[model samples]
Every structure is written in structure tokens, then in C-alpha cells.
Target: MKTCNNCGAQVEDVAKFCPECGFKFGSIAEPRAVVTDMYDHTSEFSPEDIANNKLYAILMYCVSLMGIIIGLLAAGDSPYVRFHIKQSLKLFICEVILGLITGALFWTVIVGIVGGIAIVVLAVVDIICLVNACKGLAKEPPIVCKIGFLK
Candidate 1:
């Protein structure tokens, strides 16, 4: 087992994310600064370009599929918009699957309530994603980002 840097949680050696805190495991133990550096070092895109698309990016978080459609149709040309839309789409799908599983488990009162709370917490994370987008981070939400693809 490996210890997660962010939360100090023990994870399976092959785990891609920290189950406790959702810290993404990169080749190096701590890659937060490295990733930011990589993005900052890029010369191709201007930060202002990302800042300009903040509205659509926030919409992507709040509107789910509708946000994705708008982002794809109107802001596809912008990488920042596309990135947030993809993350939003991922969250929407995750929510549906989670809802189905939780709904079935509702016979257990505690499980139902906990699952419902989890769903609401997940939704709240999207709000953080929205704020990040407005701030021009455009990074993935902690849990959704670590999940890696719709699977």
C-alpha cells in the first residue's frame, strides 16, 4: 500500500486516487505545483482568453447537459470552456448513476439519508468547480477529476 500525500490515507498500490481525499496520484508524489507550472509555462494560450469565458464556464457547472450543449455549441472554440463542459458532463452522468443506486438502497433509512446527503455534497462540489472556472483555474472537481472518464 502507498500513503496518499494529501490526506495520508493508505491506498492500494495501483490506486489512481486517494479514496479518502481524492488526491490524484501522479508519477511523482506531489504534482500540484508541477501541473500548475506546466500550465503557466504554456505560451500558446493567454490567461485572459480563459478569464473571458468565465460566464459560460459557470453555466456549464449549473446547467448540466444544457450547460454542456451551450458550451459545446457556443464556446467550443475555447479550450477552457471545453474543459469545464467535459467535467460538468462527467458529473451529470455520475449523479444519475449514483441516484439510481441510492434510490434502490432507500429501504435502509440510514443508507438512504446518507446517500442523499452524498448526492447533495456532490452537487455542491460543482459549485466549487464553477468558482474555480470563474477564477480561471478550470481544473476538475476533486472526486470527479480523480474518477478518470465516465467509467
Candidate 2:
């Protein structure tokens, strides 16, 4: 038997995850063990990596405007870029659908006004995520997006 580092529960030595806290038993403690204050995993990125990969970072930010094409390109190597690209693709698709629906419902000043407002909000969020990406920060966008389908 071995004591789990996470919750101090006794578990079999052969167990992979702790029974009490589900912490992985052996390979290495989760990053949470070292960086306990933050809840987001993106925070684990090293600053040096972000600074050196500015091009990839910018590509991820611009993915919102280019849609799936750019997103697919960005997903090639860098996991950081891939994460942002996936998120931006989701937001872009949602915005497009919303634009179509609103245009159909109210093809006048009202839809334009509301849709424009929504676009601005999304743009600002994209900008923020982009800036964070540049800084090598693992920050997700404020917008709710689904990238589960992306590999």
C-alpha cells in the first residue's frame, strides 16, 4: 500500500489514480501540486515559449477573422496555437449563424444595431485572448465556444 499525495488516502501501490482525490499516482504529480493558486491549466505555459512563437500566437488571434481555414493551419504543431484556433473557430461559426438568423428576422436598422453590438463584443474578446496569447498566457476567450469536434 502507498499513501496518496493528494488526499493522504491509502491506496494500492499498483493503482494509477488515487481513490480519494483521483490524482495520478506515479508518473508525476499534476502541475496543480506546484502551482496551486491558479485554476487554469494554460497558466503552465512558459513565458519564453510564448515570446519566441509570436507568429503562431498572432495566427491564432487572426483565426477569428479567417475562420476554419486559418484555425486548421494553426493546429499543425503548437498546442498553444491549436487551443486558441479551436476556440476562435467556434466563435466565428456561431457569429456567422447568428448574423444569418438576425438578418432574416429583422433586415433593418434593428438587426444591424444588435448584430453590430454582438460583433464588437466578440471582437474585443478575441483581442484580449490574442494579447494574452502573445504574452504566452494560457487564457481562454470569454465567449462560450465548443471545439470538441476538432482533433
Candidate 3:
């Protein structure tokens, strides 16, 4: 048996690609392997790949921009992208909930100063997280903005 480099799943030795994860295997030459390696590196994404994967990248770029369903769908077949998408979704949900609560408090009880301050803080944190995502970093949002329910 041979292990799939992508997902570490074992497959029959005669298999040219991993059945579970679809990772191709067994190149005949060093040049071919090098080309394969280049494509496998996520950080070295080409413009075409980025364009093709634009929805996935955008869904991952802002946790509060869309629903978790969209993020999950965009993250298809890529664990690294999925990780960021999931994290962003969690942060987005938290920001939404906080915004609603703060708005309600300000409008219903006239606690305008405190509610406005809370909203400002949440917006700043959300912007920071979005900026990080645009840079393709997988850093999680601040602790207060993360949804513990999913993690």
C-alpha cells in the first residue's frame, strides 16, 4: 500500500491516485514531480487559480459577510481553505449577534453610549480579521468574537 500525500489515506500500491482524496501519485521524472510540487503549494497560487477559486477566497475573507452555508460550500475539497472558512464563519456569526444585541440595547433602553462603543469595537475587530484573510493567513479572530459553539 501507498499513502496519499494529500490526506494520508492508504491505497493499493497499483493505484495511480488516491481513491479517498484523489491525490495523484508516482511521477516518472524529477521535472514532473517539481511541477506537481509547485501546484501543490497553496501560497504560490497563480492568477488563474485565484480567479477560479475567487468565491472560496472571498467567503474566507470575511467572517461576517455571509452565511456559514456559503462559506462551507466555498471551502469544498480544500482543507486549508475550509479551515479559514470555518473560522471566519464563526467570527461572523458572533459579530452579527453582538451587533443585534447592541442595537437593541441602544434603541430600546437608550443606553446609546455603551451600545455604540461595543458596536465600534466589534467593527474594528471584524475589519482586522477580514484584512488578515485577504492576505491568506489562517489566523483566528479575537477570542471575544469567536463562536465557541463550533470550535
lDDT of 2 by residue, 44-151 (tens): 555555555556656656655664455456545656556666666666666787778677866688887888787788778778867876666765566543233432
- The candidate with the higher lDDT, 1 or 3, is 1
lDDT of 1 by residue, 1-151 (tens): 9999888889999999889988889856744554343222123446776777778888888788888898888879987776777778888988898899898999999879988988998988888887776676756676776678952
- lDDT for model 2 comes to 0.65
TM-score of each: 0.65, 0.55, 0.50
User: Least accurate stretch of 10 residues (summed lDDT) in model 1?
Assistant: 34-43
Error of 3 at 9 (Å): 46
Clashes of each: 0, 0, 0
* Alpha-carbon runs more than 4 Å astray in model 1: 1-45
**Ranked by lDDT, top first:** 1, 2, 3
- Please write out the lDDT profile of model 3 over residues 5-84, one tens digit for every residue: 77889889888878997777765312543334311234544455444555565555453445345656654665555655
Clashing pairs in 2: none
